[model samples]
Target: MGHPKFPSKHYDTPSHPWQKVRIEQEAGLIHQYGLKNKREIWKANTKVREMRRQARKLTANSSDEQFQKEKNLLLAKLNRLGMLDENAGLEDVLRMTPESFLERRLQTQVYLQGLSSTVRQARQLIVHGHISIDGAVARVPGILVTRPQEKSISYSPASALNSDLHPVRPGIQETFEDEVEGKTQDNEKVKGESEDNAKTDAKTDSKKDKETETDKEEEKK
Candidate 1:
């Protein structure tokens, strides 16, 4: 075993690192989930890969009681983690994508439950200990949140975010919307200024051209 002082890598690197399509897909996923880097995506992929591998092994040993028991245990764990439904079977586990695993993360769930305005903001709140689950502070955004804990997610009692008047609190939707609208208005103003500048430049160029032509005619006279 490796030294306990240094943690081992949690994800497997891509087999074809130079593949353009795979690179684009990884970039898209990173942005979509507000992931810190491609490593988070790879970690989710690794987890899904392990689950599919186990499901394949169990499928081959369909007659073995021990394998069946282990399979049930695996399914139950996934169900508790909110990665699968109550009626989900081995097929569902086998078909699970990395997105499904990512969606179960506390950060994603916080944004989905409207606790935060965005996934990155949720991560920030979680890491800063503003978030609580089941009355305990949840400092890790990567934690796999269970279905039962979903409803229990809220701002820590001691956190300023727990107050309804907090700027980032979910109850203050108008503040967030106004901020967005303000940015949009600023962008439109900038765009209008640029367009006006372009028109002014075109008119000035035409005027200069006419003056130059008149000067040339006078020179010929």
Candidate 2:
């Protein structure tokens, strides 16, 4: 622990700061995830590394009496955070990527749940105290959301966004209405095709009936 005013950095900077491949990859992630900077990616990568390091240590000490207990605890924690499955093991933990951690952030979750059009908007809503988890405001966009907490994430009751008339609400409503309209159009197209097929079948039956009547008349002649 360091001074309260100047706490330690929770993440490590890359060894080579000028790698072209890495810089390009980081830029893509930042844009795709609407991250503020490369530092967030670095922080997520550091978390993944720490988790993998613990997994490796646990794997090496499989014969220890406390191994099963510690392994279960670690897997449980990861599962609770929605990062791993119930049946996941140390191997899965070792394979975890930084994106796995990033996806669990509140901003990403808000966007994924359709509460926000983008992660940047999600961040803005959270930082402005418009977002909440379980009725309590969460101002940190980078905070990791647990599976249980995720279910309760919504706009704070005090925020104007809680109302359907809010400016942001119209955008979301329009997107939903557009999807509904598209489905309705598709259904109408299918119905039209079915009606056309029925008419064709009826005309074919009438033509066959007329041919049968002409054959009967010729036989009578």
- C-alpha TM-scores of all predictions: 0.79, 0.77
C-alpha lDDT of candidate 1 relative to the true structure: 0.91
User: How far out, in Å, is residue 75 in model 1?
Assistant: 1.1
Report the lDDT tens digits of candidate 2 across residue range 127-162.
999999999999998999999999999999899999
lDDT of 1 by residue, 9-109 (tens): 98898998799998999999988888988889999999999999999998899799999999899999999998888898889989999998899999999
- Please give the TM-score that candidate 2 achieves against the real structure: 0.77
**Model 2 misplaced stretches (Cα beyond 4 Å):** 170-221
The most accurate candidate by TM-score is: 1
- CA lDDT, every prediction? 0.91, 0.93
Query: Which residue pairs show backbone clashes in model 1?
Result: none
Displacement of residue 125 (Cα, Å) in model 1 is 0.8
